[model samples]
Target: MKMLLLRYSTAFICAVFIITGAVSGEDKAVGQTVSFRPDKIVTPVSSIIWKHRSSTGSVVKAIEWDVDDGDNIPNPRFKGITTLDQKTGEITITKLTVEHSGVYTIDINSKEHEQRFTLNVMERVPKPEITIEESSNPDVVYLRCAYSEKIIWKKSSGETLNGMKNQDPGEFITVKNTRNPENFYTCTLKNAVSEEISDPVTERELFGTGEDKAVGQTVSFRPDKIVPPVSSIIWKHRSSTGSVIKVIEWDAEDGDNIPNPRFKGITTLDEKTGEITITKLTVEHSGVYTIDINGKEHEQRFTLTVMERVSKPKMTIEVSSNPDVVYLRCAYSEKIIWKNSSGETLEGKKNHELGEFITVENTGNPENFYTCTLKNAVSEEISDPVSEREIFRTGEDKAVGQTVSFRPDKIVTPVSSIIWKHRSSTGSVVKAIEWDVDDGDNIPNPRFKGITTLDRKTGQITITNLIIEHSGVYTIDINSKEQEQRFTLTVMERVPKPKMTIEVSSNPDVAYLRCAYNEMIIWKNSSGETLNGTKNHDPGEYIMVKNTRNPENFYTCTLKNAVSEEISDPVTEREIFGTGSNAGMIVAIVIVVFIVIAVIAIVLSYLIMKTVHESVNNICPCIPNIFGPLDCLLKKTDREPKNSAPNDVASPLNETAP
Candidate 1:
């Protein structure tokens, strides 16, 4: 029975041992799974350890943890798991940075088990530096804020900023704002982890404000503070209607934003240093401006004043022939006065009190100056002096037998009279003729021989039927000056009647006769009866005519003048028949010719003789004996007759002459 109890106990103990062993194996597996542990997490870096026992013995794998920041983190450098010694479960990370901070996961059996731990990176933003740009007027000032990182800008006044990224280095963010006589401005900058602010800056309004800004002058306003990155600075203007006029805007990284129409193409902004320049300012650009930085707002007002310049003045003076009449005119909006070289004002005229034009009369030998003074509400200017010289005496000279006239160089003054004085060749003054003279008793020259007459009121002297002896210089005293002019007389003889002659051609159709005086043809005739021709002939008609059947056929002209008259001897025409005709036929032809010539020859016989003589003179001397019909039949020439009749009378046609 004791042996049976021992067997049962052994069986019971064996079963218990098997059950305990299985439980222990399960605990060891659980312990192995929980063995990996991270003691400390370095920002951006994580570590993990793995413990596992194989069928032969226990083993350990040191693993590095993979970390990732959430949601599209840029610039991720380190990734994946790192392996360590298989015998040890120690894991560690050396480098710590912003990118190494996130959830980490382990990879096993194609499945991922993740462990998350956020690594918060602490970042500090430096204070931003602030600067203001100078403007033509102090009312407007440009502000700039600069920082190191992409920072946020906020205003204390609850103003939201348009966030900027990657602020450029060494660049200024600018804002255009107003400067108030008593106002302070403040700005602030902030980053994801840290924030900074600038000290308050104060500014005063410019003095003396108006619409008329002086050209070529400047006004400046500078703020005192350091600005921060991520902050925006703006320059704005508040209209009377309460509208905000944004002039300029500066971002932490981006340089500036200037509004159109106001600063477009007219303003310049610097990125290296925050500054703005507005060039060529005009009157229309003047206005109030506002400056906004962070959350602070400021205002400054300015007025421009302009000055005026004086214009030049002009003056003119006029004087009359009478020496007493004087006129002065000023062609300007100013006061004028007349003065003399003696430094005294003529006629006691006063400034601005004198008329624009003034006239003075009945004054003698007056010397004066014309002065014009121009003035405005602010200043006064004067014109150069205009002067007039004095004249003591003036008069005119007169000619005999001509109307007495006077041409004075200047206008005559009122109540002034001219005096006349006449002197003879004997140097004695003459006052007697048939006129009354206002002279101290005077005597006439002996050469005058009581033949001279003078009109005192008319200033005329008449010497009837002037002779050669009367030619001399006559003197007349006008005012205080003596004027002498000379005179000469000429005589002419009467002209005699002109003599005239007539000329006729055998053809009665070719030559023309005329009378002329001084080479001018006065009358002309072609046949015995007056022909249609002009007289007063030119020198070209003076020569004798050729190709005449009868040399005596006169082509005569007359010359006449007022002194004398001359006439050429009358020209006569002869008849001839050709040899082919008999005597009876020629005689019959001659009778017919005579009948036809009767109309031209009946007026004058002297004309016929003169024509015959001229015809004979034109023939060659060797042909002197040549008779009309006989010379033609014999073909022989004769010398001209030496003893020619003074007037060769034509044979009577009614009876034949032997």
Candidate 2:
């Protein structure tokens, strides 16, 4: 209980001091956030008021309140920009601008309940830099840590030195520098609001590792010891000619560092440790490097080699004159090897060929994929997977004679070279051409020598007399100084329209549709469902439409061959119906002919009876006579009914008069 009371008393005393002039100011960088309260304990708070005072003891923002006059009214000028916590009386200001830098006071409920917070929002202090200075003692290094803020010297491992942090700017730190290769130190700068750790200052060394890098790259080396009082340090390169050349020289005694004229602008040397950096390294820089420290007493050697970077190799299947053979060609500027997916090496038994061409026989494999690996002294490049299907079966068409052309969407400048290839699946690549702009003409493979023409201006190529075997993707790759163009050429099979017809059988009451072609076929209804039982749809099979519904909107027939598909237009039942049987139509014609004959005979009999009635008056009904009217009436008696003729006797009289 007494300890708790003592803690409260101490805090109360501090609060009283803040109200008086005895409050010591806290450090805060300008434009940084800082918060202070009456204490860390919560008390009864009704309303919160905040105040801002400048560093010069001038009150800037007069007042702010969470609740005043029974309304939660804040100062209207900065309304919604600042907020006060009524419960804790803590004022939070975000995005602290420069003008918000100063002492901040908070009043809880009334002006008497006041607390102070010193805020100075300022920029972060820059990191401290330690540069080596001359030291008389050979084992010690005189160093200065430079910073504008309160600086503290520390070991690079984050260990603080005794009383080193309290030192003023430009003050030097003294320590024994041993021959232990790695001595790293740094400094930390701080203010009320910001702090930063400087870059590490490690003691310079005298030796660097041997390295092998590509030409036109940077080469750097660091030594093991970089202490002050370095009497003389010189970097020398041992050239391939077995002669030593001075690259750079530094002498504490001479008060200057001098570099050799041969490496005037291409070399850089660290003043402290004698390390060297060479930019834009070339073949000439490949040699042994030596650092001579303290008049050659401590020397280290580093070996380096500058080699060329290898270009990536690209693989292409070229068409050979033999329809059953293809050539695998690789394009690169270094050594290359051709390898199949099974890891069998096809080429590269000897040195790498820039443009290597290998004749490959078509082996009827579904997948014939290959890759070309290019290698140089410094690097390796592998190409994309090249396959036979992508080469031979691309575009899936074949014609008797077709013109195949390849063109990329965009052509770039500096056209250095190009390659055209037509690879076949069943055969080898029929044609391959390696076109070099510098060579003025292309040396095409024997097969396509006379059939290929290239347009260098547009990077397009045309091949004439394209046959079925030539129905594959022709790849055109052009090499520019800055880019490569890949054009796709697909040759499709030219197929004709198929003969399709719908047939109906009246006897069986069924419909039969067939897509007649000398190839494999499949029939589909308007809704695209397969007719009959379909299995593997192999090409060149006799396919007919089965189990069909008559009067279909459309029955499409697709005839497929080895490399092409021919779909026939819809053959409706109306167009090809009644060919199977005509019994129903023949019976209907017979019935109609019989009915017409009966009607004609009846009409003639009625006319004869009427004439007889008009001529023989009342004699026919009573007695049989040998006259024309009596004979006609007797002959027609079986054919004409008694009531067959109409009762109009005037017609007969008028006919006789005419």
lDDT by residue (389-446, candidate 2, tens digit) is 5554323234556666666556777777877766565546544566777786675576
lDDT of each: 0.42, 0.62
Q: How accurate is candidate 2 locally (lDDT)?
A: 0.62
Question: What's the C-alpha lDDT at position 500 in model 1?
Answer: 45
Give the Å shift of residue 430 in candidate 1: 21
Structural similarity to truth (TM-score) of each candidate: 0.19, 0.28
lDDT of model 1 at residue 44? 31
- Local accuracy of candidate 1 as per-residue lDDT tens digits, 256-342: 777757556566544333334455454444555544566576343332222243356665556677444666665554434444456
Candidate 1 has its poorest 10 consecutive residues by lDDT at: 25-34
